[model samples]
Target: MNNNTPNNNLTIESLWQFSLQYYSMREIKEACLNLQNHFHGNVNLLLALKWLDEHRLTFPSSQWPQVIQSLGRTEALLLHFRELRRKSKQHLPESLYRDSLQFELQLERQQQADIIDIIHRIELSKVEAPHLVDDYCHQLGAEHLAVIFNKQRL
Candidate 1:
């Protein structure tokens, strides 16, 4: 039902306008909630609370945190989700790459499954020695996967 009646304090138009005006998604939702409470009988605002989050939201890098938090939505939908998308590859699984890269780069024992996987993908015959690892790195550079071998000196 619509709440464009004379006494209604909130409207769909205002909600959209509020988002444009504020850097914080939380602030926008807070403002909407306050107006909803002030009027107490507006079904339009109530309906909005259900669907405002289903849509995708991206923001300027400067406003991302506020845009994310103020929107009163899950980070998976509007925030960190982009990182998930960026790390995805058509030929490789995202979770496997992130987990393997993290484990492979960590400072620990000389062995890890991640290291083995990296070696296997690059081919042992192509790289012949420890010093040649840098050459292997150059080859892997094309894939933007060189960050995996940092091995963290510290």
Candidate 2:
């Protein structure tokens, strides 16, 4: 299929701009590399080639700022998880829950504390909840049905 249109003044700049709409930095970089093999003097190609590290599997150089911010946030969230796990090991003091079932329930609640609030406020009418659950399960590979089931029970 001849993709080129006569009305369009097709150039590297136009293609680059159009590509930016749908292609990620990595995809753009790959396209740039292919373009470089055939054409020269395209700064976008140069940026794409040099933006990547030696492995060709690292982050885009342009996203370093957001990546750094996300890394910091992730580190803090991980620390929170670690401390929460430690707290779980030590136990939250049985005095907090008089009944054993209460303790079990509380533990389950704590396990999902991060997402519980969001789940509670979720409106089933506004969105398809099952799809979200499916996507989450897909991301985790194997998910514990008990977690979502328990949350639904609440």
Candidate 3:
């Protein structure tokens, strides 16, 4: 867990790429959605944590609140569209639903960018990667997801 890598590779675009590749997996995608739907967890934040874990970097604990706050607006919008997409499935045409889903994905990417911005502003330390993700999942009473995430790590 203490395998810290150089931070040279850490970037806004890198995080988005990591998230896309990671979330495309069926198991990780389902686990993330489970945490989001049942535990009020932010999937972007979860992915950010995982990305940080992969990079062997983590920000200070004090910055956690700010990190959460950064995505508030976007998270709300995501949830709204998620609900709309779910509820409108019966009435909306498939094309419209696909558009809505695509927009939601865009919002998700924006959220990852926002997260990386916050992380960039904070002082990060080299530490065991799983600690932050573990703490967050435990805080949400979803330790199972922490396990899932760790197991799914590349």
**Candidate 3 or 1, higher lDDT:** 3
* lDDT tens readout by residue for model 1, 1-154: 1122121323344444433343144544453344334433221222222222212111123432332233333322422443454466455677876765554323111212222222222212111222221222343232121122222111
* CA deviation > 4 Å runs, candidate 1: 1-7, 24-74, 85-154
Predict model 2's lDDT versus the native. Answer: 0.32
Give the C-alpha miss distance for residue 44 in model 1, angstroms: 18
Per-model RMSD to reference: 27.4, 22.3, 3.1
Q: All candidates' TM-scores?
A: 0.18, 0.22, 0.90
- Least accurate stretch of 10 residues (summed lDDT) in model 3? 1-10
Residue by residue across 1-154, what tens digits does model 3's lDDT show?
Answer: 1234355677778888888899999999999999998999998899888888876777778878988888976887888889988999999889998888898889888888788777767777787544878878998999988988988876
lDDT of each: 0.30, 0.32, 0.83
Clashing pairs in 2: none
Tell me how candidate 3 scores on lDDT. Answer: 0.83
* Candidate 3 positional error at 129, Å: 5.0
